[model samples]
Target: MKKSILLFTTMFCLSLVVFAQQNKEQDESSDTVKTIEKLKYKQQPGLALAASKIFFSDKRYSISGFGEFNFIPVQNNVNPEMGDLELYYSSLYRYATFFGYRLTDKLIWNSEFQIEFLHYKTEESHYEIVIEAFFDYLFKDYLKARVGFYPLTIGYVNNNDEPVMFYSVNRSEVERLIIPSTWIEFGTMFYGNLSPSWSYALGFSQGLNSQKYISGTWIRQGREIRFDLPKSISINPQLNYTGVKNLTLSTSGYYGNSGQGEFIEISGEPVEVKGKINLTSAYAKYDWKNFRFVTVGTYGQLGDTEKLFELTKDENGENGQVLGKEVYGYLMEVGVDILPYLRKGRPIHEKQNFLFDTHEMKLSLFSRFERLNTHNKIEQSLEGLPRVESDMEIWTVGLNFNSRENIVFKANYQHRLNKFNGDQFPRKNIVETGIGFIF
Candidate 1:
């Protein structure tokens, strides 16, 4: 742990020197004023990097990567008898490399190769592979088309998973458990701007695999080319409005049939099941001065659960066949950039106070609260089925220190507010720290 901290500090200091040098060079250049003005309204480099692959760009091709390292130095259990203070390295969260080519002014090709290392409680570790390859064509300002494997446009976190884009050391529990961050699938989509402040996206994609859909964690069903092929199809649509200054409001939904023409033998007879899934969500974000706030709510439902249960009963056994008919979750967060108060000076340029700007150093203190219920409702007919009480509430307080728009250091304390299924579960409070960078 000490070694890690030392390494992080050294790199952080070096990054500051490099940033200072870059800024100094910019100041010496003739375009200093223009550059500063552009930075004032520009989004973080992290977002720009992600979008550059599919959107308009002058360069013929480019390469970029992002990575994050996390550690948990302290974990206090509520029950003394349960365990002592625990400490360990959390995981090498994400290592992703991207390749993008601009075939023409209106055509682009992009691909991403990513690997994530996850550690389990039993001192075991494994790696997961993620890939996103897609092609996009610009038809006009109001219409465009994209096809191939891409991240699902379900919520804010999935598309914006870059470490520098969020204030918390870890993503929200609701997004992880309910919305399923990093969810990706093969699909074709059409998106366009409706007006200066409004936009929309619609897509059709391969649907979930019911065999993998377990209990309240519906997102686990995302089939990423693991099976021979998926028979189900999903339709998703989203709308966004940014008409209000410093505010963004958006909503998205997903509907799909998960069964994919699969059949199972029940009571010595062949039975076909069509498990349908539906999800809807709405969210809003607002920025006022140095303060930022966001709220999101989502509801999900699965159809033919009773049949799905019977079909999987033999293969998964009785204990593993619990699939929720309904699920829901919500999250709320607020943050303040305290660095402006600590530094005694005016911004470098006008429009520098825009919430999305990331050219300057930022120090933020944030808090988030969330609730998730994987099995909010179940079919009454599925009697004798053991239901796992997958309901949870969580609170997190954190600090984010960004040396530059693409490099960040984070620390946070998280508390689990609700116990799972009574005294059998242990409640743990965790202290987490991490460093993230992109280039």
Candidate 2:
């Protein structure tokens, strides 16, 4: 079944590419219709072809920034052991500044510095810093080289997360739990377009640290702040196609060893165990008239985990690092623009005023469903070890109001269902609101 689906996706992308090329040729043969089509395409929501006007025409240098703020007014605590309702006031979710410079037509550099301030009802407030810097050398339309620290392209949101590009107050649960968002690492990458509508990226980077590979979330093992350099490496590859108008398809994966060439002392002997980790994911997006749809699925596995458990055991002679042999997650969402319907025959272009001149005001209602299991499967024969049940299902319903192509206001309600040790686990339902902008 999986093979069939893969084959169909490939064929569909190829057909779209052929169709688009034919359309382009026909448009070139005409004049009046071509102009009208170009204007219509530029008027589409979420398309920002003129954003680069801020940069020097000679393309010497450029600068940009983005920020988001969130507020949580109401929430219900589901910890049966506690009898208190939780309330989180507000927070500076993210603030980032970007810089870019072009050394020549074929060589360029880009960098970003981001700050995050997080606060919780039961946890202390803290701040985090993330930096991404890279240089790109373009050889041709089919090939380019990049080196430095940048976000790994393991999934869609990891590299393409702009504030106005998504419809949620917060990112999806699958992206946060299954694959780390804004997960950056030092690496060398090669990427470019394979055809007019298809592209690919491949890279190698530093691997994760097994010592921090806990049971509930393996992604936390990322060596973001290690004092020493990583001895092992990871390979990442991705393929993307946007042949069809308003449609996109992508697939990506990562493979590597997280052991960092460490030796474990077991039974009075030094033993070497290479703990391997593998992950793969695929996603698709389609926009039709007033409705939009998106879906994504991912799977991950770890090898030699039983030996890793022994090496990272707790002080009580018990293995606390019972890493799962398998983990998986998926999410699906749908959204619709309701402002057109509410206006009763008034077109989007007519609703624009001076403040919203270059963009049309939009109101969208969206819903997302997600499921994930960190402990989908575990190693057997580990005597007296308790099973870890980290399965969860989540539901989010939200509304997004876009004042412009680069600014938005969002509100959402989120519900979580958790399972632990084969029983229902207490969780929370939250009401969240936020505003985000980019320039």
Which prediction has the highest TM-score against the true structure? 1
Least accurate stretch of 10 residues (summed lDDT) in model 2? 36-45
Model 1 — which ten-residue stretch has the worst lDDT?
80-89
Which regions of candidate 2 are displaced past 4 Å?
1-58, 73-92, 221-229, 310-319, 347-358, 381-389, 421-426
- In order of listing, the candidates' clash counts read 0, 0
lDDT of each residue in 283-359, candidate 1, tens digit only? 89899999999998999888888878765554446644556688889999999989888765765443322222345
Best by lDDT: 1
* Model 2, position 242: C-alpha lDDT score: 91
Q: Candidate 2, 116: how far from true, in Å?
A: 1.2
Give the clashing residue pairs of candidate 1, or none: none
What would you estimate as the lDDT of candidate 2?
0.67
